[model samples]
Target: MAKKLSSAQLQELAIEKKIKRRNFISFSAFFIGAGAAFGGWKWLYNSPQETAGITAGTRQPLRRALNKTELFFRRIFSNDHVVKTYPKERAAKVVRVNSDIGMSTDNFNAANWQLSVVKKNGHVLKIGIEEIRALPKTEIVYDFKCVEGWDQIQHWAGLRFVDFMAHYGLQEQAEMEYVGMETPDGAYYVGLDMESALHPQTLLAYEMNDQPIAEVHGAPLRLIIPVKYGIKNLKRIGTINFSNQRPRDYWAEQGYDYYSGL
Candidate 1:
């Protein structure tokens, strides 16, 4: 048999039970409020209207966040951080070609192709492919990274972009913050920072794998900027522009990052 509690003791026990119940209720409310906040945040993150602009595709908020993160890193990035190179023996015999936006040259005449450089001062210089080839050639064997989660170790031979700029007396123009390039028909385009453009390994490549670059692989002239992802390497480049402002980028406009660095 249990002894009955005294009145005072019973009162104290009832108070204790009430306090415990209040604590439990408070805890439950806190958790519910926290959960509601988290759920609201998730909904806002996925809200297209809330996060819509230039980067408006699948997962807009995440893409925008990544772009901001990449830009922040690029701001503190080092020019000395070069892409690693491998021995020529490690180069791929045949590199895969993707993105066919600018590859179609059915009516285009390679012989008449000229690389046009537009300076910040509105000065334009039309340079022939032969003139570009006449410049000293720089060769590199490095990993060519693509944004599609694939990469290839390839050998590229071309005139250094810095050398090309110097040859054309555009060193001052090269100091611009951005460099923009596009295909002849304006089918595709890319923008680059001057730092990547001036990297020692970045090239206006005319040869690949110890021979002249085949037509299928950006022949005549193409950008071979190892510092950036392969997409920034505009192939069969027809126009080059230097700008103090951020230039328009094809992939960036399509919900990709403007600074597609390695």
Candidate 2:
């Protein structure tokens, strides 16, 4: 014997099943719509060609936006980002000194060369190569980074920048904002931040690899600031000036970060 439901009961059961199917259909449609929208948005926003066009067309506005972004990140990070250092055994071989913006002239005379250190109150102090050699010398095998996406490790020998400043009684002048160095020919010049200039590894190098600096290597004296890009390390440093205002750098004028430090 078979049992049969009433017509009304059968209609109710059918309605319930129909409602469940409709609900499921609605949910599936909603999910598909959301996925399509997300995909479209990503396609529109994440195109490199579009970004490049925007930057090239609206350079000033884009530059401002970039500056704001950099400032925001820098503030958030608090200057704590440090470059990675390696052991001397892992150091890379010295590469060619790529830039010669300030080294074009050969008019530098080692015998007549003198390094000048200026005081805030307009007093000037001068020292000779012998004076620099008199200070305790330190040698370091460290990496040199370039702003143009390259790096090298080399052996450097010289008096540490802090030691040189200490010998000249410039340690207390911490308020100084810029350290400027010029080649003997006055063609090549650089400006550095006080922090980078006085970094423990920064050196006013007179020698490289246990030998006196070669003429091509900015001999008599050159700055070996490991914390900054190679461009900031001026060779043949004939004049060292401490300034309250930001000093003019050769590369910054040609579009580079003014505070190009590690």
Highest TM-score scorer = 1
TM-score of each: 0.79, 0.68
Worst 10 residues of 1 by lDDT: 49-58
Per residue, candidate 1 scores C-alpha lDDT tens digits across 1-262 of 9999999999999999999999999999999999999998887666663254433344656576777887787788776888899999999997888877887877788889888888777878999988888888899999999999999999999999988888888888887788889888788888888888888888999999989888778778999999888889988898999888777778877767778888
Candidate 2 per-residue C-alpha lDDT over 97-193 given as tens digits, one digit per residue, 9 for 90 to 100: 7766666556656788888876777788888999899889988777788888987777778999888888888865655866887776678778776
Which ranges in model 1 have alpha carbons more than 4 Å from their true place?
1-45, 49-60
Model 1 reaches what TM-score against the true structure? 0.79
Model 2 per-residue lDDT at 203: 88
Candidate 2 segments whose C-alpha is farther than 4 A from its true place: 1-94, 104-106
Model 1, C-alpha of 47: deviation from truth (Å): 2.6
Model 2: how large is the Cα RMSD against the reference?
Answer: 9.5
- Estimate candidate 1's alpha-carbon lDDT, on a 0 to 1 scale: 0.85
Output the number of the lDDT-best candidate: 1
